[model samples]
Target: MRIAIFGKQFDPAFDEYCLALFRHLSLTGAGICIYKPFYEFVSGIPSIKLNPDSVFKDHADLPECDMLFSIGGDGTFLDAVTIVRDRPIPIVGINSGRLGFLADVSKDELPSALNDIFEGHYKVRQLDLLKLDTHIPAFGELDFALNEFAVAKRDSSSMITIHANLNGDYLNSYWADGLIIATATGSTAYSLSVGGPIMHPASKNLIINPIAPHNLTVRPLVVPNDFDLTLRVESRGGSYLVSLDSRSCILEESIELKIRKADFSVSVIERNGKTFYSTLRSKLMWGADRRN
Candidate 1:
């Protein structure tokens, strides 16, 4: 078996775990490749010897792996998406940070989790993602988001107007702080903070939520995921923010972004007993009503 590890390498916990994970895999005979960021920061520290398992400067240096280990919080997992976009790689996240909605594995489960993998005791799950296309000036198609695509303001004092067309038909204009076009996988993210509903990851819905809309009557909208949606935001600023999952960009006012489902997904590996409800109950304290 082959495995890949991706994350920020400056932290002490992560550096220790990298050695432990590598050593654990050493016994199992599974080939391991540590991402470059690991050694880039840990350089000159006492060298950690990796036998059958090894460290790599880039993805190309390592033998193709079966699993990709994300060794940080949710943001680290998000960063991993760029490394394996559209590839059929399975990711296992180790939560080394707070509010780990995406990073499922805890610090205590270290070597044992790899043991589970060697025993074939894990499950593979298909996750959904959003795709973005653009014809606006200085923009192109084929961008994607495992979480969300949001158009937000670059300045503090002004609002942006987002003109949206759903399924090739005109929809109401959104004049607000910004707008969010989130996938079912993203409903819990920024979209949720802006009055969007939390959706099941497998649900066939797209969430369109406003960021501080000028009109109170304008509510968050959910549409069938298959619909063709074109969203364009017009603003006068140095640069407007266009985010694809964890990756973000700043563009001029002449650009537009069209969003829909992606052709491929990040195959996140999960343990047998893990469920969305369990994450919600434990991590988010969902439905913890005080008035009950």
Candidate 2:
């Protein structure tokens, strides 16, 4: 079996766990490849010397691997998605930081996780992604977001007016700092922070959440994933920022944005005992109360 590891620069606190992961994987005799940047980051560390089968700097250099391991936090996991774009390879996340929603596995669980993978004690789950459409491409050919697609005012103080339409029918005009269209995978991300309801990962729904809306009555709405949504933003600065997970770009107010479910979905590796509900309870501290 072949596994590709990807990560970005992380705090020194996570260096040991990262090194341990590499050492354990290398010992398994599985074909190992590391992203060039991550390999360079650990080059100076005496404890972590990796003679990987391949060192990849870009997606084109990524060889066919059975699985890809994303090291670091959720941001690194999102970055891993960009490389595994439209690929069938299942990506697993190894958390080396706090609050790892996407990077579900902890350093303590690394050995068991690997054991599960090697012993075929894992399943591949498909995650839905939101695709962006615009006249001029902002995020290149890979315009899909695993978490969400958000549009917000560029300036800090001002709220933007986002005209939204669902299936060519007027939905509502949002007067807020920003708006988020999140997949079920993203319901726990930016949307949840702003009072959006959490949807199960298998749900065929999308969340339309407003960020600090002028009217309190305008709450987050859930819609079918199949509907095509259109958005036009008007900001005082004449520009707005649109983010696809960790990637973002500024766009002119005149640019119209369209969002729909991506034709493809990313596969995530779910080891035994790591279910959606279990992750929610552990990560979000769901139902944890001293009084209870």
Candidate 3:
């Protein structure tokens, strides 16, 4: 099997685990294609020696592979999505720090997870993505986000007013710090911090959540994923921050933004016996009450 590895800089404490991972992969006899920068970072460790079949700097040079291993935090997994955009490569997220929704595989689970992967005992789940349209070359080809599309006030202490429309019909004008349009996969991300409802990953829903809205009655709303959303921002600074996942850029208030579910989806590898509910229970400590 062929594997593509992508990662970011990690703390010195994880050196041993990283070394073990590389050593195991080397023994598997799988063709390894790694990110150039991450390869350099790993090469700096004296205890580790890597001789990858190839190195990719970005999406263009990324070779076709059966799977992609994201070795870092959740942010690194998100960046990995950009590298494998529209590709059918299933991503395996290995957490180098705290347990993350994307990077759920912990250090203790690494050995078994790797065994399951090599033995073909894992499941591939498709994750929906949101696409942004501004009628300009703002974000270019990388305009889709697996988590959410957010618009926030930029260069101003004052709050921004976001006028929203659903399928060309006026919905509501939100007077708040920002607005978030999140997919089911993103409900636990920025939207969750703003009191958005957590939707099951399999649910075909989108969340329209406001950030610190002026009105107490304006609550986060869940809508069908098939609906189209239009947003126009009115900010005191005449510009606002538009973000798709972790990537953000400044946009003028005049630019009309449109959002919809992307045609394609990202594939994530889920090892057997590891379900999303179990992850939620373990990661969020759901139903963890002494009385229970």
lDDT tens readout by residue for model 3, 1-292: 8999999999998899899888889899989999999999999999989999999999999999999999998899999999999989999999999969999988878888899999999889999999999978789999999999999988547999999999999999999999999999999889998899988899899999999999999999999998999999998888999999999999998999999999999999988899989999988999999998
TM-score of candidate 1 to 2 decimals: 0.88
Shift of residue 6 alpha carbon in model 1, Å: 1.2
Which rank order by lDDT, best down to worst?
Answer: 3, 2, 1
Which model, 1 or 3, shows the larger TM-score? Answer: 3
Give the per-residue lDDT digits (tens) of candidate 2, residues 190-256: 9999999999999989999999999999999999999999999998999999999989999999999
Backbone collisions counted per model: 0, 0, 0
Task: Give one digit per residue, the lDDT tens place, for model 1 in 1-292.
Answer: 8888777754564667667766677777777677776645545346456443567654346447788888788888887776766677889988876677788777777777777777888888888788888765323333777778888998888888889999889998998888888888789889888779999888988898999998999999999888878877788674588877766778877776778888887898877667888878867887789975
TM-score of structure candidate 3: 0.97
Q: On TM-score, who's better, 2 or 3?
A: 3
List candidate 1 stretches off by more than 4 Å. 13-16, 42-48, 51-63, 136-142, 287-292
Top lDDT: which candidate number? 3
Model 1 worst lDDT run, 10 consecutive residues: 134-143
Instruction: Note the residue pairs that clash in candidate 3.
Output: none
Candidate 2 contains a number of clashing pairs equal to: 0
What are the lDDT figures for the candidates, one per model?
Answer: 0.77, 0.91, 0.93
lDDT value for candidate 1?
Answer: 0.77
